[model samples]
Target: MNYMDNKISFSAYSALFNNVDNCIFTRNKVSNQVKWINKDDNDLNIKIKNEKRLKRILFNEIKSLYNNRINRYNLEGFSRINDEKIKDLEINKFFLVEDKFKGTSGQYSVFPRTFYCDKCGDLRVFSNTDEWKHFDVKNCRNKNCNGKYKQFNYVTFCPHCGQIKNIYPKCETHGTKYLKLIKNTENQKYWKVKCTKCGEFIDLYYSFCNHKDIYNLNHSISNEKSSKVMLLPVMQNSIFRSVVKTIVDVQNLEWEDNVDSIMLGSYLGKFNYLFSSNDNVNNPERILEYITTVLKTFEPHKENPQKAIDLGIIGPNLPQIVSNIENTITEIKKNYFDEEFTELTDYLILKNYFGDNKGNKKFTEYIEIHDSFKREFEKLKNILKISEITYIPDIHLISSSIGTNRGVSTLEDNYLNHFEPHWKSKDKDIFKVYSYPFETEGIIFDLNKVEVVKWLIKNKFLNGDEFNQFMDEDEAKNIIMNLDKDGEAYSHLKILLHTFSHIMIRRSSLYTGLDVDSCGELLFPKSAAFLIYSTSNINIGGFSFVFENSMIDWFQDVQLDIKDCIFDPSCLDDNGACFSCLYLPEFVCGFFNGFLDRDVFLGKTDRYCVGFWSIDIN
Candidate 1:
């Protein structure tokens, strides 16, 4: 058995880099269309930090892809996503491959399959089979031709159905086989394809191709439909949108497993600091104190703590809430697993807690307020209207891309739906996915809850009555999170944080020497904060390094950059954003660069200074 081995980054194997299931590939110095071997190696499997939620999200994505397959194959038995437990069988064909891969194929050919011989001026189109043996030896079919064959770097793409086709010559005499490629100008866009026999040529271009003629795409159209196919360079950026989803290795604290009693106790511990002084587990009176302290923080329950408790509002488990708190609170000190807060609820509760349970450097986070240059940090945080500047020394991320979005950069739903779910072969179906692991260091800027609400209301993105009832940060966060989609405050907060994150990334890139895209942002709008960190596989000691050494410089540069865009008067005159001011690469910006406005950062360039990051804070 012959084996071919190749080395490529897991990132390169993604559809983003063009080595997808049916796309053309450039191996060594030669290029050919490719298909991965229908088998996967377990060694290639990597785990995302939050596998359960990751599985749920990926199941939806893969299921959509499998569903998109044309129905005529009678490809029934599509399994529904069972969120109860995401087992191996759920992702059977998903191959999470690493850096290197090996496989053997029955046949591989230069895509377009069209070649030109300079010596005899003959153009030859090879068949998909091995019948053309002489071409394999690096020579042309013309009897007296001594020149080597050269492949064209162009192919035709169907804008309608995403089908790729080989270029065909349009001459009557020699048809496609005896054509010659004539370069009319230095630019290939002006080049022409000619038939030597007829002395006739047409510009290398896009035209009509019958959809039914494409080999495997069967479900979309009838045999009579013809569509205009665009001629694109093989490596053009628009050919595919690599559908990779990168998520933080978020840690869920099993908050749901703890019922109402222990829940109230946790709230008491975080809000009232009850755990520090109380040691008696069975003391009945301290339990009331814990419940009362927790209730007083809520406006509706403050006037009647025992009434809410008796009415089964706070801890429905009754005696269990008190007993579980006594038992579980100390277990955290002895045998409990380490805790790392990633979710908004956990971060919201614990970040406000003074109890000292934030875990180590590896699990979830290690956050300490940015106080290196106390004065500058205070000024920057105040100007940015953020309450805390958390510096996490280590951050880990898992990212995976499936399928290919062809013909446009806009990733339409149907394109994502077309990713192959499983390789089908007579009970040999196996799930495969390619996942890449990245580790780096970064920081999170927690916005002031009060300021966020004020900004939202001022911009009319939020109603004053919405969050007014909840003064406690935790209560406000819960209410904010549970609000429906029309609650414009939730989305605008994302925009404010998203736009703020881009400014930091663009500024940090200057210091770190990484492309702005190499940095990724994760917005916890519910928490009113965003985590900006290195997305690159390599860890160059990112956000923390600058935090320790040059945070002031970092803050200063960001302010100067945003204050005056080179496209100023015009850009600020518009939405307060343009490419020159705040736009990031399409894939880099989490929102597809939507909801961004420099006005969010600079507020109004008008007489009224009403922006969140506006320098005119009174």
Candidate 2:
């Protein structure tokens, strides 16, 4: 056969066997022998030639057959094997079929193939197949029919009234020879029943007595049967409503599972949808009010300290839900986890000061303490470190009097400026000397000549000019001293230097301390003091001087005289001729009085310094 394999025809076999006859006898003589081409009749030669044509025809036919078989196999083979796949392909077919059916019919009724007699309550078999065998009853229940009840009949019924009025072939919906009085819940009295068929409540007291045992038809007593009615403990209004209102008022807020979050959870938009839409069956306000009433109602019950108490109207199983919400509310309130408080604290801590007042420093210290407490608060929140109260740091002002008794001040500039020109240094040692001289007569010179002469003079060993300069000042005052003998020019210079030194030391105190020891020298003792104080709280009063006992003792005497040790307002006063008001000459006496008078203070020790006036009363 000329079977097509990849579209290649196998025609070569026919070509090779075209001349080979069925009865061929061949003798091969290679060198001198004779060869017989055919041993059968010539008809066999004719058959051989025709066999090629036959084979060609058969090959074409068989190839066409195989092709057809393969085509049909794939098309129908897969279709018959898998039902689901065939159904998917047939979906379009049903749409067309349904379209045709829909045009012809509105609706139809399907009747039972077999049924019991309505009047007699006897079962009959009107089954479609012979497998449903029928047996004869001794007496037929139908009073009118003379026909024996031996076989099942397919009866016809009226379409309008649902009666089996016709019998041989069949009918739909109606037709009956005798009346069948049905005992359903709707018609009978005394037995109260809810009809599953029509969802109508009926009392079946009258006609239903005959079938009472079959339906368990008693209605007078409570059965205590399981019925899914209403969900009890319907929610009411509450603080929960306020929380939810707050959450809905805000946006994109969510809270964790805790009392705080639960309380605040509503504010975080948990039930925002309710207020936006009035579709809720229960009034929103009333719902919250009811919930609040329920909670408050339960509050007293909790104090009774009994386990597993019944919650009557709310339902027995609602205690857990109520408790959970209560706890969550409590947790949220305890944390003060509100945006307003956080914002206020942030503003307070970060506020900046304007002037050079030390009050700003105290405010800055307050901010530091605030930040530290905030950190601790956050840590406690996350770790749940429970406490009745928390310790918070206080800030106090850096006093103006800190370090007054701590370090030393110098007297060189206060006492030595007048001697500066007449003084000399030999190998870093300064010394004072007196001179009276003439320029040529070294003691007598003009004031300008005397000033230049003094510039070149040495104190330890007076050069010629130093000797002349003092001689002029001595004589200028000598005529006046001869008028008033004790008048002194040197004393005025001493006072000017003293005021100069005091100004320099006071400026240093603005940075370090006022009682600066040896301002010109490198080695000097310095004192520093710090006081701590507290700010107002929601529940507690303010505080001051917050520190340990050791720290207080190290910097100050334990016995603090509240009155004298208090900050001095007048020390900053500069009205009269006290130390602060002193000019050049008076500055000397005031500075000396400030340094020398022990009465200016109480006694102090190396271990402790009494502040301001004294430890003992005047």
Candidate 3:
């Protein structure tokens, strides 16, 4: 056989071996008849009984190609044995194992069945259902075999729910006693069950029923199609090494004395009007002004309370005034503090970006900056050495904490809390879940940017005493611990970069004909790099076109966009983001819209006055 054929045979062998091993490990005795046929000799049928012996034989067979590192597959955290175990193991009527390497042009079957041609020795597998029985005779590949095939009817027990039944039942809501098995264009099998009473369609149970094997060989084969059979270790090691290097790089920078310096802190105890007013207050500004006026009148009472009280500067109605202000603010907050986007446009935008992408292509780009902010642009250019790149996007599934850890409460807590059940339940693992794919258009920022930012924080932005006051040793230690483990933390530079990325994503979406949720951002604050890109399934070609056609215009527009917000002045004075501005859909954002402050990007707001844009070059 050719080398390509040999690799395919080995992959199939590995898959089959893993499946048998899984079946045995689960103590499934019903489907014990596992067979492996030799490609060169059709008469040779190897009945696999001892899984350990089979592993040794297979390991020896592939050892020459993979060296002695074949043992890596058995290691904890890397092996199929460590994967989630299948709750139930039931043998269908029959299982047919096919030799893909030796098979004739049309001999191999998509699923396992009991049909074995007596003349050609070609085995055809089908789903052990009534619908499959009707097509079994017609599916035989050998034309001269006279449509002869054997069928086996064997009963098996379900490992999950401990049910021993001939057939899985459909939802009772559907009048049909059972679901009908159907195949899509991809040849994937699923049971179609529609509930006429409720008009509800359910696919989840069907997927669960079809993929019963703990080690799904079909899924393994499909996943391995894009990967090298022998280079799996090399790829895994490369990723591990890159992550280690990033962590080590961060640790090495710790020697810079100002590493522990606090660039920003949560507005917890600080007397900020933003946190003082509750959601019910329609106009926080007016209430804040009134409070300021009331406080100023108490200035004389600060030194001489009795004299001021006698003068009516302090009165019997003081407590009533305080209660009235507090109640109004509380009522306003209770009414208006909502995280869910009110408009259908927001939902459509989110769906466009995160919903299943039928087409397997996506394009993204960095918008150019305007000439007016040329100085800030130059600084950014210097920090991130921009370059063109081309590569497949690496998509990842990530779960994040719902609420912000900064002590400042947000409307997201109420909306996102609903997902807590799904997060905990294995069955309903859909809500608040997100898939993020990286864009090739990214830059590796200059390390000097980190040093410069650190220097600015230590020397120019904050005094030693002020820095110490904000820096919490225990909190810093906890952050470092999290960084070492998961590479996530609330570093000053990270917050700055994260905030900047949000502004860019929001602005880019508007110009690129994409929704703000369609655009996602990746921040590498440790490296001072951030990438903003499209998260849509199909290549809209809008971001790339916008960058190419109106790069300067896009950047100029972004600068204008971030300079002011619809809820501005108030948004600036408060937490620095709102539904009308930086907050993005849960799917597109990594941080869950936490640690965002536009003032950190624009430097125009009274709060967080020190910003990258405001940094003096001299």
Candidate 4:
């Protein structure tokens, strides 16, 4: 017989050989040598040719031996034996003996299988080979009710100390304490122990009972658990609705080209399909159930049963279970499908910012105009006067504020923490920033016509000697030279745009029926553009309506408002800015309300330096 032709049959025979005697065959270093070790310390060595005939002969001999033993023993199910009975048995030393006794398959041992009759509450141990073969189909042997047997590992605890008895045997803290089985009021069996050290009764059985009661436990164990569970139902509903809304929003977004929209639509379709097919995605109850099941299996074995009960694992601790379920789902989503899901999620956020007609237009125009503007200017440009303007309506705005308590604002902080030079810098050296989440309706103001900032050294508009007194001539020159050599002009443009953005936000809020605190600014200094918008948590379209209908009035007011401040001469002289003039709400200003000086835009009152607008004369 060809080994290849009868490979499937031979594989079945090999499995049978493994299950019956817990013996495995292996090839020795020398060719044609086969070695077998049985659970009874019996070893069989056979030498044969490297042919199918010899292999079949060896297999048949092993099978015959196993069958003879089975006939003699006539074993049924699992047989209980004392430790001394298996002393000479060739058990695999590396295999966990406990796992074998639990009726789980191990590297060695056979003729012992354990199962519990769920309905009859009867535990059965089978020692027969035929019983193991038919274990799954067996029914309860108890009288009056025959229920199918469920495989379960029997757990026992020390009556004296409540520690797991079989595993620990002797507890160092409590000495040798043997567990005695006792019955509860319901006649259900349990293990109990009393600690001799303190004469305190430790109820191991009660802990197991508590673990079983998790399905019905009502009270929450912790505040965090309560909060998470309460939020789970709401989060589940919100997440599904958000996914659907995102899909619809992606569909309605006016892409510049059909191809981009089509590609995005295709991706959204996949996301929708994935969510729809997974029933658990929107089912908080199902997620909670899964968490409970996993906790029962793993947590009970590793943690104190009472602790698990307290966590609501053996009870209705909805919040704790909800958190676990949420974490599990998040991990599954991340690992599933190799990060395509995460990419789609990021794309959805991108669509939210740039999906509308106004957003699309502003984004495209900014790109086109910035590229042209960068090449035209030798140095950074500042707003001199508006030559042309277009108002994009219904642009969404998001703003956040940060303070010292909340650490640095991710949106505004620029200093690198990991940079070696800056690592030693103190918090006082930087502005204290914090961000509060805010969202609102907004507008985009498109502009054309530009004026470039002049080199600070050549500007003789005011008192040069006074300017040098404040900043060293060499430091000022270096700042200007660095702007040219390393393209620091971009930073100058950002400062100009940022300052102007604050002015517009302040002025626009005054006329646009919004408070200065409610208005926010988004700066695109690299593009030499900025947008002033609303940042109220509620989406009131008042600002967008004003920009759409009365933009000319808003623009005129902004220009007039920035010409001078109520605190000017002083505001312009001392740091060139103040709360009455330059500073808006921290949320409205992007750079933690720092790095602003009206003199950068408007020429200084004392004419110590020329502004960007003043450079037009030279």
Clashes of each: 13, 52, 11, 29
Candidate whose TM-score is highest: 1
How do the predictions measure up, each by TM-score?
A: 0.64, 0.12, 0.32, 0.31
**Model 2: runs farther than 4 Å from truth?**
1-263, 271-290, 304-314, 330-618
> Tens-digit lDDT track for model 4 on 1-618?
111121111221111212111112222110110111122122221111121222222223223323332333232221222223222222121111223232222222211123445564444444445544544435566567678654332233221111121111222465433222222354323333444445554443233211111223452211121110101111111101100000111222222122232232333231222234645443322323343454446543354555666766555453454344445445444433212222232233233332343342333344355564432222222334332333444442211111111111122333211100000123212211111112344554422212332334334422345344345433443333223211445455556667777777776655677778666565543224455655454556676556445444554544455667788667767766678877875434545566676776566555335565555432
lDDT by candidate, in order shown: 0.55, 0.24, 0.34, 0.36
Q: Which lDDT tens digits does candidate 2 get at residues 177-210?
A: 2223233443222223333334444321222112
Model 3 clashes, total count = 11
Report the C-alpha lDDT of model 1 over 1-618, residue by residue, as the tens digit.
011223233434223323445455564444565455332345343444555545555555655444554332223333332333235333222343443444322123455556676565466666634444445426767767777776665777765445666665556665566577786577765678877776787656657766553544454343435677677766523454455555554443232233222333343343233444556544323544465444343436646657867887776444444444446545532332212122343343233232222431311122234434667666766887767666665455666554455554433433322233433232324454445555666677778776776676667666767666346665555544444433567766777888888888888866666678777777777678777777665677766567656666777766667778898788878667778878887556755566676677666656224678653343
Give candidate 4 misplaced runs (Cα > 4 Å): 1-383, 387-390, 394-440, 446-450, 453-488, 557-560, 566-568, 605-608, 615-618
RMSD per candidate (Å) reads: 10.0, 56.0, 24.6, 32.6
Using lDDT as the yardstick, the better of models 2 and 4 is 4
Q: Could you give me the TM-score of model 4 versus the true structure?
A: 0.31
- TM-score, prediction 1: 0.64
Tell me the TM-score of model 2.
Answer: 0.12
Q: Please give the lDDT score for candidate 1.
A: 0.55
Candidate with more favorable, higher TM-score: 1 or 4: 1
Query: In candidate 3, residue 508 scores what lDDT?
Result: 71
TM-score of 3: 0.32
